[model samples]
Each structure stands twice: as C-alpha cells, then as structure tokens.
Target: MIVTIAGAGHMARGIGNRTLAGGHTLRLYDRTRAKADELAASLGQAASGADVAAVDEGAVAGSDVVVLALPFPAGREVAAAWAGALEGKVVVDISNPVDFSTFDSLVVEPGTSAAEQIAAAAPGARVVKAFNTTFAGPLVTGEVAGRPLDVFVAGDDEAAKRTVSELVSSAGLRPLDVGPLRRARELEGFQFLHMASQERLGLNWSSGIAILP
Candidate 1:
C-alpha cells in the first residue's frame, strides 16, 4: 500500500516506522519541507529496504491511505482542505481532542469526537479513528512489555477498517475493531483518561493500553 502521512512530528515518526516495517511505500508531507525531508531520511535509515520519500502536498492525492498525524485542529483543517483529494481513501485520524492546558476534558463538544469532526470535514474520505490510544513511544516498536499493542479501530466503512487493521497487524500490533465510526466518542474518552493517568502512574507516556483475551 502507498501511505501518505502528514506532519513530521513524533506520532508521524512512530507511524512511519510501522508503515515502512509493514513493507509499504511511504510519502511524507509537512508544512515545513525540511522537517519532512529530515523525517523521511531518518525513517529510510531505520528501514533501508523500504520505499520512502518526502513529497509535496500535491503528491498526497496519489496515496491509497492517508494518515493525518497532526493534532485535532490541524487534522480537521487539513481534511477540509483536502476533502476532494481524499475521496475513497482510507484516512486515519489519530488525535485526541484534549485541552492540553487543563488536561481534564476534551476540547470538542459533548457527544462528538475529533474523528467525527474530521469525517464531517472530509465527507468523501473513509475516516477511521485509530492509534489515538497508543503513545508515540510504544508505537515505534508496536509493543510493550513483550506484548503487541492493541490498536482500537472504529470506522463506518468495513473495507477501510480492514485496510487499517491489516496495516496494524502487519506492523506487529493487534487491531481491535471496536465498532462503527461513532464509537470514536468512547475511544477518545478512554484515551483522555489514559493520558491524564500517565503522570499519576509515572508512565512517562510510555505505557500501552492492552486488552487481554
């Protein structure tokens, strides 16, 4: 699969690592071209056999899947901007709408989530809520404490969900199909508590939330 990831931040690195490890071609884009180039080079070094490159925004339309690794607001803005380009693509939203200052509640209105807002912005895209519960640190290796990370997936389209699930599994993580896209509400809520508990639990953003069989 050809995967395009926006933003060259920590989450982008983590997800990019997994994407390359899954043997998929990766194209990276960021507002600052230099950042994207740097990330692309770094990922290429880590996975030498993988096909990867830093590309401009215009190249994003060619991707089979596009992962919006930006924050909630930026994700929504970009989704709106690229709504036409994202049509029929599996677009993954991995953001939690938490207010960083308070860290006690989400920024989005009640009864909705970042994934839902992003979906509405890009009506033609197949939006899926995933990776919000997984931190950047653990995502790089796709595991924690000798166990695979469980990626919670929610999407309205069955095939889109399967695509993401396959990618997650290919990267050596467990993909749990929680339900339809609306279930993003609970996933976002659950991740908020997980984020808040990090400091209290001394997890240092390294913990992984797992569901045992």
Candidate 2:
C-alpha cells in the first residue's frame, strides 16, 4: 500500500514513519520542500517528497489511502483541489478544527465537524474522522510507558473506517470505532476539552486520553 501524506508536520511525519515501517511506500508533500526532504531523509528509502498539487493527486491515483494531516483550513483547500482525483479513495481527516486563539472550542460550528466539512468538500471521496484526539508526539512514539495509545475512528462508511483502523493498528496503536460520521462532533468536542485540560492542568504533550476497562 502506497500512503501519501499531505503535510510534513509532526502528524504527517509520525504517520509516514509508521506507514513506512509497516512496509508501505510513502509519498509526502508540503509547502516547505525542505521539511519534506528532511522527513524523507529521516524515513529513508520508503519515503520521498513531491509537489503538493501533483503529488497529492498522484498519490490518490496510485495509493489505496490518502491522509490529510494538515490543519482544517488547508485540508479543505486540498480536498477541493483534488476532488476529482480523490474519487473511490479513502480520505482520512486528522484535523481537530480548534480555535487556537482561545483554545476554548472548535473553529467549526455546532453540530458540524472538520471531517464532515472535508467530506462535503470532496463528495467523491470516502472520508473518515480520526487521530484528532491524540497529540502528535504520542502518535509518533506510538506509546506512553508500555500501553499502546488508543485512536478513536469515526466515519460514514464502515469499510473506510475499517481501512483507517487497520492503518492505526499497523502504526502500533489501538483503533476504537466510536460510531458513524456524526459522532465526529463528539470527538472534536472531546478534543477541545482535552486541549483545555492540557493547559489548565499544566500537562505536557505527553498527556493523553486513555480508556480503561
């Protein structure tokens, strides 16, 4: 499986490392070509950098899955630009849509989510909402102590969710299916609280949301 990631930021690098380690080919694209090149260097032979427009659409064309690891606004733009190219492919939305200014709530309005908005923009693609609740540092590390990090996944399509779940598992994380697309509202809302808690409690990025039996 060839996995293409749109951003070379923390999240994209984390996912790319996991995907490449899992034996899949990885293509990464970023506005900063240097960042992509640096990441590809870190990832070795399985990873390479390319132009955003051409690489994004080309990855969708050649790969089974495409991960939009960018911020919400950027993800939307990419989805719109690659709408036709993303048809029949599983698009994973890992954005939280949080208002960084206040860190109080989601940038998306009530009853809607970033993932749903991306889905709306790319009607041809199957969108799955996931990875928003976890911090990038933990995602890259894959665990805190000895316990595997839990990744919550939600999507309109069960098959798409399954595909994402498999990727999560492949990355050495536990993927929990929280329900359908609408549940993304809950996930995003939960992320808002989680972010607030991190600041309020003065916890580092190492802090994570864990579900115990």
User: Against the true structure, whose lDDT is highest?
Assistant: 1
Tens-digit per-residue lDDT, 94-157, candidate 1: 9999999999999999899999999999999999998999999998888898999999999999
Q: Give the count of colliding residue pairs in each prediction.
A: 0, 0
What is the lDDT, from 0 to 100, of the residue 143 in candidate 2? 85
Where in model 1 is the C-alpha error above 4 Å?
none
lDDT of candidate 2 over 68-169, digit per residue (tens): 999989999999999998888899998988899988788999999998899999998999988888887876667876688888899989999999898889
The CA lDDT at 166 in model 1 is: 95
Model 2 steric clash pairs: none
- lDDT (C-alpha) at residue 65 in model 2: 86
Give the Cα error of residue 92 in candidate 1, in Å.
0.2
Give the lDDT of residue 149 in candidate 1: 93
Residue pairs in clash, model 1: none
Listed in order, each prediction's TM-score against the native is 0.98, 0.91
Against the reference, the lDDT scores of all candidates come to: 0.94, 0.82
Q: lDDT score of model 1?
A: 0.94
